[model samples]
Target: MTEREHSTVVGQLPRTDVSSPLTPAMLTRLVWALWMASLGLLAVGATWTGPGVAVDGLTVLMWVVVTFFSGIVHSYSRRYMAGSDHLGRFFYRLFAFTLVVMTLVAADHVALFALAWLGMGLVMADLIGIVRGWPQARAAGALARRYFVASGALLGAVLALLAWATGETTISGIGAQADALSIPVWAVAVGGLILVAMAQSALLPFHAWLLSSMTAPTPASALMHAGFVNAGGILLLRFAPLVTLDAMAMQILVVVGAISALGGKLLKTVQTDIKRQLGCSTVGQMGFMIMQAGLGFFGAAITHLILHGFFKAYQFLSVGDEIERTQPTTDHESSSMGVAGAVTTGLTALAGGAVFVALTDKGTHFGSGLVLVALVVLTTLHAVRSVVGAASVPAAVRFVAVPLVAVTAIAGYGLAYRAVDVALADLPVVTAPADLTIVHGLVLAAFLAAYLAIERGVYERSEWLYVTLLNATQPDPETLLTSQEEYNEY
Candidate 1:
């Protein structure tokens, strides 16, 4: 059947238009109220002098971010998911997930943290399969649950090991005694935490769960991308002391993160579905966040995740706009840039780099800071490439837009980086940059090669590579909907 016909059939499914006493409007208000409370807490946290485990800047920052995203998702869902079945249940799971995330970030006790982490995974699984009658949703939820369970189990083992080794039940206590632990115990604990972060953030091999989770509603998807996936970065930041104990472990993170970043971007290019494209994008973005943590800049990771949350939330919430396409791009629209455009792009990138270095105080000398600056410059160039290369746009307009966009982006990043750095200052090992090694060099080489190949469309020319990526990105067969009738039966 044609796309329009399928949409018609899907749209014809029964919807409960009759509003209950606890309506979407009511739920929206409730979410806003929670947001307000979180805001107040953030304010109090700024001046909080009392002794507490979870009342630090990191906890309050996360609380505000979670509630803000939750509020946006709820407000969007009120209209986007109107008349949908299980609306109340959706709201319930969403709120629970938000609360669990907040608890996970704020928990100072190892046991409480583990429980909150587990609870988060469970709530997310429920939301993924909110439509019980839909087999695809159920299968998707099951797939995600397996991954999440494994992540939780790894976390449990790590926490138990830390508590046992340090004889400390509290997270801060474990961190205090982490350095005193034996090599084997520390190695195993760190390894487990790495795996937990990998699974939670949907990095590399652990990314299938996220790619297959399209069965979730748009709001859930937003929350998953905006808040849930970010938990990995938060986890890393919270355990920064333990993670930064070993140089090899940090290098491992860099390697894994680089691979996932390149692989996810490649996969995104081949995805036909918009949601799946965004999923692949999240994998790539999360890879960057992990890389930042690996570089001993947990503050940067936090900043990245926060900004990414806002970005992905907007992307998912406004995804309906993607369906309403106008005219397709012609060959002329995809034309290459001229000499003038190239010069402008180069200057814009340079200006972005200077702004980044001046404000963030990175990349002044050699090491990971230099690498970060290079990445930022490349990112700036990429951001403006489309605009500069657009044959339809006037040259003058392209030139003007490139610098304006670059300055804004770089300045914003710099400001956020400073704020996060200060907020996380009380935490140990939050910005311990690892010395560059041969392994890092090799990883950087591979990353650049992948980036070049992607930019040049090498994968498009190589049928083997294209098919490999396409097959690799496919959701599990169990989660696949064979026909509209499968879900339409409800």
Candidate 2:
């Protein structure tokens, strides 16, 4: 291999290697200005007397998340990638991506949304391939480009059909004019758009690019996971009224998302590297998000988008930091506590459902609300179990801790649900149908069964699947971790 090919970081700050004129100071100032502008526009969006703008509470919330997280990523990358030859260009592309995302969320016109949607793909291409000379990074960029281009075309076609149906080019105007569900052609358009979302979201057949993303810098990977992938769901939100008009589109999303979610979860277990594990996690998370959109919980999906962005972004940027991490060690008595754990989480969810019923007259989303309660319960159970002490620990303490954690998680879910429910009341987004609840329940049960199987050593005994996943996901330690050191020697 050539000397330059092996080098991951450049040591020289010589002006000769600079690709773009962007400096640290300039990027910092831009971030500040971007946040300030987003906040101001948010207020305007809420109260603007304009007929074309559709800035709702959810939009404002998403804008804040995108802007705030973009700033965090920019600052972290500036330091983490301090010595890259294309450092200036790197920040510039990230900035551009941030703007495109904000525009995608902010625009109420189909024309503007289309432009921003495609622009995001273009910027993501550059951002993902920021390592420039690396062939693997370039290939990842190519894959991303292919998905984004196809997504953009499908979205554009959907928009054209919408405009044709209602003679309205603006998001709110079209929704105001169309009874799209009655029109079979428009229903077909929405289905096409769902395909676009599937592609853009890295679902199943399209998910390879997401796994290949470790070639990019950590900040870039974080941006894709936390911010970029959510763009697909956001796009769905924009056309949700029409999207909900089609049953086939909904079925497509549910089936594809379920498959992708299951695949991602299974792949994650066997991956040897931390970053690959996170990548698989994202694939699974995005699948669930798509499922949320399919179920008509557009608002809930947006909420997930923002929360997951914060979570995965924090995980990525905080890598290698001196954060306290809990390691799992099983206790003989802990196995016996499974019944208690189940009781705590189950009661917590029941309480959450009760609260929802008491507070809201319109239970338009009982199914999704119930799912939220279950998720909170599951998370709390995991957290509590991870920290469970030896059998010697006081029974009273463990009992108290389990319920307390469950209640806290349930309460958070309830509050977030109520707020989002109110914000999205006018939109068509809600829980899935009653019949699908059984399907969802069965899926969750299966996931739990798999978890127990793995915890109980089923996976360890399965040598073929375990070895195959490890081989596919484990990075070359010498090339990845030691490249910079070796380059320094050279």
Most accurate candidate by lDDT = 1
lDDT of 1 by residue, 306-399 (tens): 9999999999987866675445555345557879888888898889999999998888866777767777887787778768888888767798
- What tens-digit string does per-residue lDDT give for candidate 2 at 85-159? 777888888888887787777688888888888999889887877776666667767777877888888888888
Q: How close is every model to the real structure, measured as TM-score?
A: 0.93, 0.81
Model 2 gets an lDDT of 0.69
Minimum summed lDDT over a 10-residue window in model 1 is located at: 1-10
Q: What TM-score does prediction 1 earn?
A: 0.93
Error of 2 at 248 (Å): 4.6
Off by over 4 Å in 1: 1-23, 47-53, 324-334
Q: Highest TM-score: which candidate?
A: 1
